[model samples]
Target: MSCASEQTSKNPMYTISKVTQSQLTDKDIFDEELDKEITDYDIQEAAYYAQKGFRVPLKSSIILAQSGAQVPDAYMQAALSNYYNVSVYNGFSKNKSSSNRRKDKEQQVNNNYMKLLRLIAAKGGQNTIIVYWGTIEKGDLDDKTNIVKWSQYEGGKLSSKTKALRYLLKFTLVDVTTGNWSSYSPVNIEIDYVPPKIGSSITDALQIDELMKKSYDNAALLLSEKYKDKTK
Candidate 1:
């Protein structure tokens, strides 16, 4: 019986275990690739509308959704209210579960986004929705150099050797009427100073608030350029 058991173990089912481990390791990369593809598709769809000279009506109200770590609604409203009637929708919250299959996860996100759009339409009679989110990444020495150059261009000063953090603000505009959407990253803010040695939490909060304001302002300008309102 012992010999027979040893022989069976030699041909044990390692393939299933190995395949599962491989998948676990590659899940993140797979999700990132799929996200990039989805973003590209959104941009292409927006471009198609642009080619056809589509313009969002200035009079129609636009609903806003902030995916994570809520940036104050006032920031976006202040940035874009001048161009269009805009309001922030606080009813939607993101689903934050990790998934083994990225495509299914992507589909779930899309469904949630569309559901929010429909909700806004039903509740407020709004036909357009703009969803925004942000990500923070540690920056390298090379990024510091670029920050210094940008500061110099803007007549501001930044230390070339200071550690930096990159803040990426990504946003999308969807016209619910046609289910047409466009996405953009109008500005990437790299800051040399964050989490001050004293009062780190408060200071970090303030810094993020300021950066969010700047990002939204920049995005508003870009959106205005890309989706020009038809002149009456």
Candidate 2:
């Protein structure tokens, strides 16, 4: 109703300052310097979060994302903050999307899946001689096409038509001891892969494959060396 309000209503430039204000304060500052602040928070929180939870502010997410690697402190810090949950730092009106929460979901499924695999391995090891599992296939476990069941049995509770436990970790164990190693004749080890629907987008699939290939190829070298003496 006032002159400035009327002018703002008619002119886009008048309202542009509001957008600038939104970015600079009370929101995740995307500016390079603000990103640095976020990274510092992330690293400090990550080192402590196992002992402290929500106390880690939204800014600390940088550490959460990058703590998986071992690298120089500066690069680790930068990577930790490089990508973030874009949804948490901004207000609801400004959020328009929620990537942060989605990332947590994906991580939850993957972590639980890995746990389940370890459980299976433990069971196999305990019951008797280690039971060799063949390959894992992604999606639709036997008669259960319902992904919710898959996710739940896999230790999750999210049910969406568009997501899945899309990553699989697979490897075969080999015995490399000599004559005693003959007792350790090499054997291929494997885990079934059921790539989750949400996590297995083409890009993710490629990354998973790359990891698996590298591991399997390295594993093969050990097996090959073990069998070489026998063949000769």
Candidate 3:
């Protein structure tokens, strides 16, 4: 009689080598460093693509109030063109009363005057438009108590108490395609003016024309700074 015995395979058993704690930690650090490098390379590539060709050449139209109480045509056109770097056109006209009436009716219904302006700009082949208006009112001094004061002028001439006048200039820029718009009003300008004495024929007390031009220039400069990306 023979006893039965278990037999082992002739091939050696597969064994995994022991990994120390230090070895495992080093491998994790190497993997983290590799991931960081890949992430940095992706960011650099994205930035390079964005800076290649983003802005396109555009043309703009400028529309002033119909009352002809805005900035001079020549100055407004030149200032905006230089600051915004776009071809500027005058979209104001005195003979568009019929069209104006129709637009007014539509504005009453839709309450979107900006959309009307965009339509006008689109007709003129303008990608953008600038519309501006201004108002003048009496202003008080810093103390807010007195609106008039005796101030000395050039040559130390003392005149009667002069009143202060505040000028507010409001302007808006609209994108014809998107109908997106921005409005701005630069800080108002206050000037002391000696009103013409009763029965005096002198009418130019505050030089309203010059003040209007100054306000328009300030508005253009502000717009240029705020929308610098639109430049060319």
Candidate 4:
């Protein structure tokens, strides 16, 4: 997927929408034409709010399904949707399984998110980007453990009364890029949130983190189950 680095820093980003399918066509994606069109929609919407002068972030959703699907359309219609765009590098692949496409999309999307998290973490952490890199590079790259845990942090406390803490979502940066993985640009960002109290009654913030963690895993599992080696 393409990132608008030059255009993005003009404003900050926050708020994320869930990934969904859209009903775009191959003719729509030729030469990234469709993404550009929608990205323009995102820019205009951002500008509209920029004129009003708000610190709101440019938020967009990733494509979890095919082109021209409802998720993208719904996000496009969101009051905040205008500030964001959808992406799925493999969404238009006519030769791949929908599940595999979704997994690839999840990996790629999370990698991008991790970059943002890394920047945020670096603001107050002892670890530097170089240290983070060395850790990941030392392992069997194919294994998930080889991935870099940018660092761990306390997302928040469980409660004012209970001394117990909630989920500790590890901010992981894994490689999901297309070519030689020298940069963090094309990777998927995974927030492996593991909550503390997983049962009922409590906030279960850890559960929330677990759910986030499962999003990527589920995408991969679904892809493997549905497509096998059929990915194009």
**Candidate No. with top lDDT:** 1
Deviating ranges (above 4 Å) for candidate 3: 1-75, 84-113, 140-162, 195-206, 230-232
Best by TM-score: 1
lDDT of each: 0.51, 0.26, 0.43, 0.26
- The alpha-carbon RMSD values of the candidates against the true structure, listed in the order shown, are 17.4, 25.7, 33.7, 20.5
Q: Which stretches of candidate 1 lie over 4 Å from their true place?
A: 1-54, 69-72, 91-113, 140-162, 194-202, 230-232
Q: For residues 181-212, could you state the per-residue lDDT of candidate 3 as single tens digits?
A: 56667786665555566687643332443554
User: Which consecutive 10 residues in model 4 have the weakest lDDT in total?
Assistant: 130-139
Could you tell me which residue pairs clash in candidate 3? none
Window of ten residues with lowest summed lDDT in model 3: 12-21
Superposition TM-score, candidate 2 onto the true structure: 0.18
Model 1 agreement with the true structure over 1-232: per-residue lDDT tens digits: 0110111111112211222221111121112334444678777876777677646666567776555322324566677777777656542343434345665654333334355455656577777777665554443345544543211111122233435545566666666666555677875766555435654463544554565567667778777777777576
- Model 4 Cα lDDT, one tens digit per residue, 109-209: 22222333234334433121110110011111234454432332223342322222121111111112211011121133233223345455534443433
Q: lDDT per residue, candidate 2, 1-232, as tens digits?
A: 0111111121222222222332212121111233234677665654564342121122211111101111111221222232221111111122222333564573222222122323333443311111011121223333455432332122222222423333222222211111010112233333344334655563434433443344334433443343332322
Order of the predicted models by lDDT, top scorer first:
1, 3, 4, 2
Considering summed lDDT, which 10 consecutive residues are worst modelled in model 2? 174-183
- Clash count for each candidate, listed in order shown: 0, 18, 0, 17
